[model samples]
Target: MVDTDSVTGTAKELAGKVRGAVGDLIGSDRDSVEGRARQVQGTAERAYGEGKDALRETADRVADAGADARDNAGRYYARAEESVRNAADEAYHFAEDAYDDGGRYLSEGRRAIAQQVEESPLAALLIAGAVGLGIGLLINTRR
Candidate 1:
């Protein structure tokens, strides 16, 4: 496309030169001046077309770079998301194991307390009263 425009402009320039020469030979100053103006207009138009072509090419390159950058960013985000999901899954399993261990410990503690209460009712009552007092004090402090 650029080559075609360049060729057309060159042809126009040559035609203008020939017309100007003919007008000069015929002693027509107006025709000669008009031919010169045509030549100048053709040159300006060709320059404008070249500038436009350069700008268009630059815009296309920039767009292609932007698309590549976006694609790379998307890939990175997907990988990061997968890593976070895997980490979350591992944490969930760890928490479940900890909960199971805590439950077992609590069960054993409850059994020991029951045996002690059964062996000594008076001691059990005293301990229960002490625990209640401590809880009441904690509540009062919060208030």
Candidate 2:
């Protein structure tokens, strides 16, 4: 990236040198002093331009670094969101399986109870009465 200020300053500096040489050859003190001043001004201008270019380069690098950090953070956020979604899905599946197993266990227990009742009606009736009495006693105790 060429700086226009630097190029202009360089051109001005060269012109000043030529002007100073001509003044010296012709014995003109005013022209020589003016030429030297112009040279100093040109040097200052070139330095200012160089400094500006350096600052611009630094700013560009900082901007690029910020963009990279933002992109990385976005990727990390997406990965975290996916991980959370996967965990939620796994938890839901686990709960569903447990619920199905619980239902199956309840149905099997009812079937076994029915079978026992069919095999021994008198025994089942006595057991039912005992269970009812036990429940009644527990309820009265709480009251």
Candidate 2 on 1-143: residue-level lDDT in tens? 75776787677778778777887899765566556556655655555556556655555555667887656655655565455456545544554555466567768988999999999999999999999999999999999
What C-alpha lDDT, on a 0 to 100 scale, does residue 91 get in candidate 2? 47
> Which candidate number maximizes TM-score?
2
- The candidate scoring highest on lDDT is 2
Q: After superposition, how far is residue 108 of candidate 1 from its true place, in Å?
A: 99
Q: Rate the local accuracy (lDDT) of all candidates.
A: 0.63, 0.67
- Cα-lDDT of candidate 2: 0.67
- For model 1, the run of ten residues with the poorest summed lDDT: 44-53
TM-score of each: 0.40, 0.51
Estimate, for each residue in 1-143, the C-alpha lDDT of model 1 and write its tens digit. Answer: 47454556566667767777886889665556555555554554454455445544555555667887656655655565455455545544554555466567768888999999999989999999999999999999999
- Off-target runs (Cα >4 Å) in candidate 1 are 3-5, 67-143
